[model samples]
Target: MSTTGFDYTITRTLDAPADRVWAAWTVADEYAVWASAEEVVLDVRPGGAWSSVMVIPGGARVPLTGGYVEVVENKRLVMGMNVPGRDEPVLMTLDLTADGERTQISLSQTFDTAEDRDQAEQGSNFLLDSLTTHLAAA
Candidate 1:
């Protein structure tokens, strides 16, 4: 299915450089840490594929698969994530801006319905919170 527009967007500033923030998304090990994934494989180039097995609460494992549509180093990334139970992959765009020692990140995702988008916001916030913690420790 084709998405008309993004349904959800969230922005956060992290206490880390843009490069580091980018690594957290592009690097397998770093992504695994913050994403709470059992395994992660990332190919951070245009048209490259990425996959991860996320370990959710109660020991359930969920597989996430995606492909990179665009990559601009520490500046921007756009990908399509195949969420379970969805007919089409969700388009995700992440933009990063470096402000001295901090990085401002804006993430947008497209969903088919407003209810789905609203429900996903909570999970997105939790994921970003994990990223913040990982960055702080790094």
Candidate 2:
């Protein structure tokens, strides 16, 4: 999408180091666990591609595809996400900042409309919560 700016932004602090949190996000196996995906393939680098198949509530599989626009290990990631049913891909940015033993994550995403942004915010929150649970168990 040719969006001018990010439409939604959310931040959360995880009780783990930046490297640990970064691994959870970039490692395919770790991501699949927290994301509840049936399969995941992540190529975490600039110009790299990633894809996942998520099993929804009714056991329906939804495929997510994306390409990395920017990548900075343990620091930041920018991706162009090809969301289903959308005409254009959404631009998503994740920034990680370390604070002693904790890592603060800020996620920003662009959507075509306010409603879409609001909906995405809810989904993002759920995913972040799952990440927290996954880290706690690690």
Candidate 3:
């Protein structure tokens, strides 16, 4: 893939409603159940802060901090991510569309540099996959 693009996007059709998926992402306890984080603190509204501490195998902790730029219940969300050691914040948008009893999500993360975007892709995919599993267990 070319490193010129400013955003990297991933789309998934989940076997759950938009509201359910939205709650899973926005609620601290719910997010912790599905995400790759050992701890989560989320305030689901514009200007609110969202943070998590991810614990990798063998006990390495990686902290992530972000703030909500925009939020629309069960529909859309835009957040800003402050990557460790990076001066610029990465922007992420999550759009949800209802599809009968299911939901289709389009997630896009825009970075200041291609290197940052590329580095984030792998973990993003893992989180999405975890979401799928979490929904299935519900």
Q: Model 1: clashing residue pairs?
A: none
Q: Write down the worst ten-residue block by lDDT for model 3.
A: 1-10
Write the residue-wise lDDT of candidate 2 on 29-73 in tens digits: 999989989679999999899999988779899998989999999
Please report how far candidate 3 places residue 39 from its true position, in Å: 2.9
* Candidate 2 residue 135 C-alpha distance from true site, Å: 0.7
For residues 1-138, write the lDDT of model 1, one tens digit per residue.
Answer: 235743778999999999999999999998998999967999999989999999997999998899999999999999988877878677788999999999999988767677878877878888999999999999
Kindly state the number of residue pairs that clash in model 1. 0
Task: Evaluate all candidate structures by whole-model CA lDDT and list the values in order.
Answer: 0.89, 0.89, 0.86
Clashing pairs in 3: none
Q: Give the lowest summed-lDDT range of ten residues in model 2.
A: 1-10
Please estimate how well model 2 matches the true structure, expressed as its whole-model Cα lDDT: 0.89
